[model samples]
Target: MSIRHGLLALLERGPMYGYQLRAAFEESTGSTWPLNIGQVYTTLGRLERDGLVRALPGGEGGQRPYAISDAGRADLGRWFTTPIGRADPPRDELSIKLTLAMSTPGVDVARVLRTQRKATMAALRRFTRLKQERAADDDLPRRLALDAMIFRAEAEVRWLDHCEAHLGRPG
Candidate 1:
């Protein structure tokens, strides 16, 4: 997810300082992605330089609030309407590790898969438990975020099982 776009979306609600933007970003994403205050300010600075946001004057304790510019609104609108293309898939660390492990001598490929599967299952369980525990009171955005995580973890487990099965097959 683009922190730049995320900040702009939050600023659409109104002008907000770095701390407020960071908190709102975490809240909107169900705290799955935590942002450092420094990172937020850095991104804000970039946004300001790009004319996507403008600094408002005289915030409390020198916390300069930023309002999204018209350009920012247009950019945010494009982001919302545009389908995220997977043409250039993000590199998966697990995939990289497994590929290297298979080729590296004495790497214990089986152990690698087993360890990852165990970790993924634990994460899946935690996500499931959170879903069950908060089913009654959680807001829609948070529930959706949690659900995505649960699905991804579940998929990872299935992929690991497939990998194990492939390991036993004759070459």
Candidate 2:
């Protein structure tokens, strides 16, 4: 996830202190991605340095709020309009582990796949339950986030099954 873009998106609303930005980010993502206060501040500093944001005068109790600059607004707009390309996908740790397991002596690839499948299934169940429990009027962001996770988990399980089949395991 792009913390820089996330913070810029939040600042698009208006000026916000570091704590407020953190809380808003968590709330927007349904707490799926929690941001540390320090991380928030660090990103803000970078944004300011890049001229994407400007730190306003300190408010009461010395709370320094940040507001998005014109460049920030343009960047945020680009982010929203651009489709996320998967040309360079992030490295999946599980994929790396499975690949290593295949080449490592004494490593049980089937057992490893089975273990991951079981865990992924459990996560799918949890996401499904969350979806069911979500109220109709719940924020769309949270619902969409949960749906994305559910879909990814389902895809993972399918991939695991494929691996098993290729290994000559019984369907």
Candidate 3:
């Protein structure tokens, strides 16, 4: 997730302190991805430096609130309109581990695949349960997040099955 864009989007609502921004972020995303307080401050500093956000004066106590600038609004607009590109896909640690297992000596690729499949299946079940609970409450953001996780877990299981078959493992 782009913390910069996320912060900017939140700032669109109004000026907010670092802690407030962190809470809003987690709340909006249903806590699927928690933000570190330090990270929030760091990103805020960078945004200020980039002129995307300006620190407001006279914050209560030591807290420094920030507001989005016009540039930030334009950038946020572009971010919303731009489609995420797949030209450079993010690295998958599981894929890297499996590739290394294939060539590593005395390493059981089948065992590794089986273990990952089991774990992924467990995660899928958890996501499904969460989805059901969220659906009951009509929590749209969390439900969407859970759906994404479920789909990814399902895909991982399918890939593991393919790997097992390719490695001559019995079904």
Write down the lDDT of every candidate, Cα atoms only: 0.95, 0.91, 0.91
What shift in Å separates residue 50 of candidate 3 from its native position after superposition?
0.4
lDDT for 158 in candidate 3 is 86
The residue-level lDDT of candidate 3 at 7 comes to 98
RMSD of 2: 2.2
Name every residue pair that clashes in candidate 2.
Answer: none
The sequence of per-residue lDDT tens digits that candidate 1 reaches over residues 1-171 is 899999999999999999999999999998888899998999999999999999999999978899999999999999999999999999999999999999999999999999999999999999889889889964999999999999999999989999999998888
Ranking by TM-score: 1, 3, 2
- For candidate 3, the TM-score is 0.92
What alpha-carbon RMSD in Å does predicted model 1 have with respect to the real structure?
0.9
lDDT score of residue 37 within candidate 1: 91
The best candidate by lDDT is: 1
Residue 119's lDDT in candidate 1: 95
Residue 162, model 2, lDDT: 82
- Per candidate, the number of residue pairs that clash is 0, 0, 0
